[model samples]
Target: MTSFQQLLTDLGNKSLSVLDRNIPKSAYVPLDLSVTNAALKEVDVSSASKLGEYINRHIAMNEGKVAYGGYLEKRGIYNRSDYFNQQNPETERNIHLGLDLWIAAETPIYAPLEGEVHSFQNNTNFGDYGPTIILKHIINTVEFYTLYGHLSLASIENLQIGDVFRKGEQIATLGDASINGDYAPHLHFQIIKDIQQYSGDYPGVASQKDVVFYQENCPDPNLLLRL
Candidate 1:
């Protein structure tokens, strides 16, 4: 195994699930290209609305509340011109850098660990993370940051930098397609080791050329989610 993977294994049992403990493990559905039990193959996931409908149906059929996306999965759902390349499909940013929790609008999001709000902003691009928040945490003297994207505008209304949040504290709420960069309701949770110069926002998707760098910079969020 790579050093990063070993690190995550070493830190096992020290992390927390971003979701509520009351939610059973059976309620979390693994959504990747390998999922063949759903009608995903027939749906036009390129369209955000259609993707939303597909996710809703999957959740209902599985009797689950959330649909989880794995790290590094090449999600074809981001084929929108506003988000990906319109002319050259080869340059499309399809590799997801974080874990996606697909759920209904207005669902509460909690901090998986103790941290302070680092920065926040409303990225109004066509297919961007409308309202985003980043938190800085120091665990065992190792500093890191966690990002929460595609949130309701009201979630950042009164938020300020340096605001401290306890583990499991409600931080934000999921947003709808209208204000969440015109996509389905969900939470984009990411872990970053070196944010570089970014403040409120960071790239949640990377190209093939830079996938290796991101894979190391942004380790598997399941390390913390454990779900």
Candidate 2:
């Protein structure tokens, strides 16, 4: 049986671009809610260790999930409430299993490794994940996949499944409110292994009961990005 450490080592060996050096050395910055003045008007999240909790609460109220993404149900801060498994299969629920990099629209997004385009779709709707993309990657011969959501409409215009993408290759641009499911532009990234018979849209967030499945299927992206 494969072990988690082995998985981590295998993933570490995969072709991935470190976000640290991708941006200009001076331009690279930590995620600070205060920098943009959200702290002044909203909650203060300057402390790094406390950031996660702040963000989790922010999403729970603002987006209905601990992680930021498409909340299919409708029960959150946006006056929207979407409990993950309320109406979905027994397998789906509102639990967050990934880290979200919130930034402005059109932020360049790149492939983390050499992989094939597994699927793409325009998950259009209010509070939806527009222009989503999933890539299948094989590392150490173990099969797994990564998901990219809330992308610009033009991102996948000329792309197709089975197309090959190299590490650092520009895959898409961040979407604005009009096309990105109506929230601040950001990247909704998740690592997925078993898709569990879902397509175009898999649960970006799961419920507490389903946390173990997501944790195993969607390993912390920090292992790859360290972002």
Candidate 3:
């Protein structure tokens, strides 16, 4: 029911801290997610060479063949297809929808601003977001959604929808590999305008075919975090 302009105003007026800004230096470092130092890597996969490499890596990992590619997959294999059908355990297609901030386990996650808890769910599964939480915030008269995924199990145990929490409050802890979908623990933060009838967990990554759908439904969390 809130207007978008008013939402922006509320966010501006609210005292919010950027996710990486003011946090301890340790929080920014990679915790448990496999990481690579590829500064020259292109952010987008437009070349055949780049796209081919991405697919090969994905196929290798899904087949249980250990390779350096798994490290990238652990962090997140960029711009890869979200479909799977030939695995030992049947899998469904669901691309990630947000930028995953990979880091070590047990990092403290704080609320970006004061808001009410909108929803929470334990989405435990391989290749699935685990222990996700969505917060409904009103900024400048606009209503938006902030989703935190790969969270520690304790984070959602006591929370309820509509429970008010203060800015910078300790809302959740980062989940580690054992429970965070077998990847390094990190916060998967996303900004959503409409949940589209989905609750508990939303896509954190999407395929090129889904770019437009994701772009409108899920805005960049950086709009609020600026990180």
- For all predicted structures, in order, the TM-scores are 0.90, 0.70, 0.65
**Among these predicted structures, which one has the highest lDDT?**
1
**Distance (Å) between predicted and true CA of 173, model 2?**
0.9
Error of 3 at 115 (Å): 1.5
Candidate 2 stretches greater than 4 Å from native: 1-5, 13-15, 18-21, 24-79, 83-94
Decoy 3 TM-score against native? 0.65
Alpha-carbon RMSD to native, per candidate: 2.4, 8.2, 9.8
The whole-model lDDT of each prediction reads 0.82, 0.63, 0.58
Better of 2 and 3 by lDDT: 2
What would the per-residue lDDT of candidate 1 be over residues 20-96, giving only the tens digit for each residue?
76788789987663334356778776577888888788788889988997588876666654565444545667788
What local lDDT score does residue 189 receive in model 3, on the 0 to 100 scale?
Answer: 75
lDDT (Cα, tens digit) per residue for candidate 2, span 109-136: 8888878898899997555688999888
Worst 10 residues of 2 by lDDT: 70-79
Candidate 3 residues 1-227, lDDT tens each? 23553354456455454243455432332222222535325433323344334434443544521111121122333313233222322132234455556444677777787788888998875646779888888765667777888888888888888888788887888887567665545568777887777778776755445556776677555445433
